[model samples]
Target: MARSVRWVTGAKTQWTIHGEQLVDENRHIRLSTADVELPDGTRFTQYVARMPRCAMTLVFNDQQQVLLMYRHRFIIDQWVWELPGGYVDGVEDIAAAAAREVEEETGWRPRSMEHLATFQPAIGSVDQPQQVYLARGADRTDTAPDVNEAEKLDWFTLPEAATMIERGEIVGAATVVAVYRALTLAP
Candidate 1:
């Protein structure tokens, strides 16, 4: 069976605002008009952002557990268990950012890592696309954490993590998604 594809219409930048110090908002498709002619002549206009993000799932083999951080989110006003990750700096590769974040948050380094998945939590409003990576054979060398970002660090087994998810102990969107994926991919 042949599948049909849609084409984009002409679009223009309407306005932009600073979402954060590093990220910005762009209302580019607001002025879109003149539908583009596709091979099948079907057209569509979609608002999108080109934002970038980085995330990691840290798995420690010796303890047979995953490294998680219990951090207080100011926006939510609660501490939640989550995997360590953050936004990638300018021109920083995703793998480097993942390793840096894991070390920054948990004071541990992974011996190896591999790309897992990419997701966009909110396509309608937020333009951030989170890059998820899996870190294997991690080793703990220190207890220091990025004090400004997280509070306590802990390790959880797969079953314990499932329980935490069910009990709502793990709340961050990216963390939850990544953890779930890791559990499924676990050997």
Candidate 2:
């Protein structure tokens, strides 16, 4: 049996700059608007922002506990528990980025890492795709927290993680999704 796939076309009609921000007083992002046409004879406009892809990791220590970060997101105005991760640098490989992120955020280095999965949190609007990796047999090292990103770091058992999710403590989409997947596939 064969399944048919539908393809849609969009044409850019107009683009305008809305605003810009200096992320670090040097790097900046310019938000813009664009009018597009749909293949189904529909016309619409969308606001888009250029961003970079990010890499994250689900790291398990010798005790089988997963590393989690307690961080505050200004945009969301709340603190949540999340996996350690960050944007991919142009000069860095994906696996390297993942390992770097884990080390920087959690102070743990994995003896072995395996690719787990990749997902777009919001494909319709956001351009960022998050790649997740599974790191096993991690050893705790000295940690230097990136104060701008995370406030606390800790390890949680699977049951504790589930409770956090149920109680709305761990709310990041990628963190929650990755944790559940890792728990299911854990040996």
The most accurate candidate by TM-score is 2
User: How do all models score by TM-score?
Assistant: 0.71, 0.80
Candidate 2 Cα misplacement greater than 4 A, ranges: 1-30
- lDDT measured at residue 38 in model 2 versus the true structure, 0 to 100: 58
Which prediction has the highest lDDT against the true structure?
A: 2
* Candidate 1 lDDT (Cα, 0 to 1): 0.73
lDDT of 2 by residue, 5-122 (tens): 9655684434333443432321223355556565545766676555677888988888888889998888899899999998888868887899888888777887777888888887
- Candidate 1 residues 1-187, lDDT tens each? 9999965569543333222232344332122222233444455543344555756665556767888888888898877888888878877888889888888877888778898778888775556778778877787767677888678888888789878988988887777787778778847
**Candidate 1: residue 79 Cα off by (Å):** 1.1
The TM-score of candidate 1 is 0.71
TM-score of 2: 0.80
